[model samples]
Target: MKIASFNVNGVNGRLSVLLRWLESARPDVVCLQELKSPDERFPVREIEQAGYGAIWHGQKSWNGVAILARGKAPIETRRGLPGDPDDSHSRYLEAAVRGILVGCLYLPNGNPAPGPKFDYKLRWFGRLEAYAAELMKAEVPAALVGDFNVMPTDLDVYAPQRWRDDALFRPEVRGAYQRLLDHGWTDALRTLHPGERIYTFWKYFRNAFARDAGLRIDHFLLSPAIADRLVAAEVDREARGWEKASDHAPVWIEIADG
Candidate 1:
């Protein structure tokens, strides 16, 4: 089975880009983030016409997430992460697709460190850690996939010194990510291609893409039950080169049928 995660930036604005990739790649399951639209405004028809059924949680002009299952409708599991009833951001969407529990998340980009936004990012990581523990305890085949917004290690970034003070590369943020992996979730890409310089996101500034200066913030963490089935993991680097492309490209993993 092929499963992928992409931060589309804006689902409607990039509908054509997304549809084109879907047609060409034809991933069996896809997790999308950064819809930048409200639930009512999601381009459901366009997605459905492309042969995928989706469930999404959207918020206006900001964070949102969704899951798409090819030739089947994902069984909706949850719309938001547990442990934060007061938190209103639409950043998480979970579903059951083909016996796998898929958790799609758009983690907050805590830019301009030493600020409230950064604090929120840390808090959100705490919430994610808590729920991840629950999922591990459940022992179900699962994959937590999307834009994690953190460079887990210096190797995951093109230039570690440049991002030293940035929230995404902060020591604390990296520690939080490590704690998630400590819960027995395998980092699919790193596991498959250890020591390789792989990246999934590049800023529009300073011709980052042209220079191959990028960050590997998008990720796939599979529970042990499914990690053993991991066959391959990769970044669709060509998608990032397309016109009107998202700053982030698609990352996908192929797993063997048990």
Candidate 2:
């Protein structure tokens, strides 16, 4: 099946553009992030009308996530990342679609490093790592796809040196990501296009998109059992160029035959 992950930034603002993309791409499943609205505020009617059903977790103005499936309602499995009772952020959502377990995450951005927020970012990564390891034990066809807010390598950014201080490309952040790989999940996009300089997000200022000044922060990690099914992966660049567009584009991957 075809599965895609996209950070729409704001559903209310990018509804029309999102609809257009849905009509064209026609992915079997989609994991969305950065909804930036309350659950009540998400446009359920518009999305349902587009022929995709979803399970979402949303907050007031930050860190919401959802999973959408074409012509079917996803089976809700999780609403938030594990490991904390008080830690509430609309950052994680998981569901089962066609027997595959999928997680859509909006990992902490934690910009302006060397502060409390960055610390939280790393702590959150640790929690995710632990949860990922636990999921690995299940031996199911699982895939975690989302805006992880991490750049795994120098090749992922237009200029690594220029982005050293950025939250996404820091050594600590990359190392944390590597730890997840060490636990046996496959980076699907990297498996398809190893060492490539493709990016999924671009800033609005400075003509970042036109100049191709961007970062690869969104990703999909498949369990070893399902890794063999990893197929095509690409970033839908045009999705970021639409009116009132989101800073992020969509990244998609096709799995083996059902």
Winning candidate number (lDDT):
1
Q: What is the Cα-based lDDT of residue 206 in candidate 1? A: 99
- lDDT of candidate 2 vs native? 0.90
Q: Which stretches of candidate 2 lie over 4 Å from their true place?
A: none
TM per candidate comes to: 0.99, 0.98
lDDT for 26 (candidate 1): 96
Counting only residues 3 or more apart in sequence or on different chains, how many pairs clash (N, Cα, C under 3 Å) in candidate 2? 1
lDDT of every model, 2 decimals: 0.94, 0.90
TM-score of 1: 0.99
**Residue-wise lDDT of candidate 2 within 1-258, one digit each (tens)?**
999998998888888878899999999999989888899998888999999998889888888998999998999998888998788898989999998999888899988797889998998998899999889997888999999999899888888899899888788999999999999999988889996788899999999999999999999999987898877999999888888889999889999875
Worst 10 residues of 2 by lDDT: 9-18
lDDT of model 1 at residue 117? 93
